[model samples]
Target: MRILIVEDNALLAQGLSAMLEALGNEVLGVAGDAESFVTAVLADRPDVAVVDVRLPPSFTDEGVRAALHARELLPGLPVLVLSQYVEDTYARELIADGTGVGYLLKDRVARVDDFLDALHRVAAGGTALDPEVVRQLLATRSDPLTRLSRLSRLTEREREVLALMAQGYGNVEIADRLVVTERAVHKHVGNIFLKLDLPPEDSGDRRVLAVLTHLGAPRRTARDGRDGRG
Candidate 1:
């Protein structure tokens, strides 16, 4: 796969570039700032782009903004953003559109295999959100009562399954984590969609939408009293 790196830290950028190349993937180029990152992206059109959440000058959310702009220029372009901290706002913005995107903590890169897996997942138009990011998003609520009311429809187990799904874990991985059968995880996922009133669609899209629904500040509604299986 051909990849592009957008990190302001020269050492980190070189390290990432070397890692990608060592894995037999082509490294198009490394851009240290937002402008250069967008330029490289529009010009090379690489298979995937690995970006840092912060960039030159402000070192704030320049990378996030640049990434959004690049996607605007090249719709559906796969992008995997690496961040040092859990910036819930930026993470939500990246996954707002769903597929072909990922937001992982910079620490995960030390886990070479897992990091590569996330990169490939994003490259294949799949989501790869960090579990820490999901946890932070779930916990960052202004109104505890409203948040509880909105999620009151879901059973404890179903909520657990949904959180794992938001973290980009598949049924098998979720099952492994929860020490349950894969079928049980699938059933929980289905129930989550049903209780959330998400329409029937591709399972991947439903997974993302379910996460968005959980993260978004929607009004509380009446709850269905049905018990979830598994």
Candidate 2:
């Protein structure tokens, strides 16, 4: 995979470039500021872009804005934004785009293997958000079940699975965490979708949609969870 690195910190950018290269991906280019970041992406059209949430000139959210702009130009272009802290607003903006994107804390990069795994996931058109980011998101919410009346339909174990899914765990990982077979996880996922009236999707979009629904945002529900006898 060809990757573009957009970070103002020269040392970190160099380190990330080296790490990605060592992991068998080509480094397309490195950009220090917003303008240069957009330029490199548009010119090179790499397979993925690793961006910092803060960039030069103002260092506010230039990196995130640049990544969004690049996505506007090249829709579905996978990009992962790294931030120093858990910012719900940033995560919401990235998730709102509803495409190949990720928001991870900078600390995650130290876990080299996991960081690379997340990068590859986002590059392959899947979502990868840091667990802390997801936790903060849920914690900041006043009522996570406000819009999700279907919550009652899910068994406690299924609710557990959904929580982990919102944290960006894949089936195998969730199974390992829950001490269940992957098949069992698959079953619960399907049932959750059915109960929530969400169409199954392989690209991970539906899972995120379900998470959004679980987080009190109303989405279309196709069926009632109860048999109407209760």
- Top candidate by TM-score: 1
Cα RMSD for candidates in order: 6.8, 6.9
Instruction: Assess the local accuracy of residue 219 in candidate 1 as a C-alpha lDDT between 0 and 100.
Output: 22
Candidate 1 residue-wise lDDT, 1-230, digit = tens: 99999998899999999988998999999999999999999899999999999998999999998997898788778999999999977887777754788999999999998899899989988888888987777777666676667668899999888787876778888899999999998888878777767654427644664556556623222241211100
Once fitted onto the true fold, the runs of candidate 2 whose alpha carbons sit more than 4 angstroms away are: 142-156, 190-203, 213-230
**Backbone clashes, candidate 2:** 0
lDDT of candidate model 1 versus the reference: 0.81
**Model 1 bad stretches (over 4 Å):** 200-202, 217-230
123-220: candidate 2 lDDT, tens digit per residue: 88777888887767656555646434666788999978877787567888889999999999999989988887777663355577457545633432
Q: What TM-score number comes out for model 2?
A: 0.82
Which TM-score value belongs to model 1? 0.87
Model-by-model lDDT, in order? Answer: 0.81, 0.79
In model 1, the worst 10-residue window by lDDT is 221-230
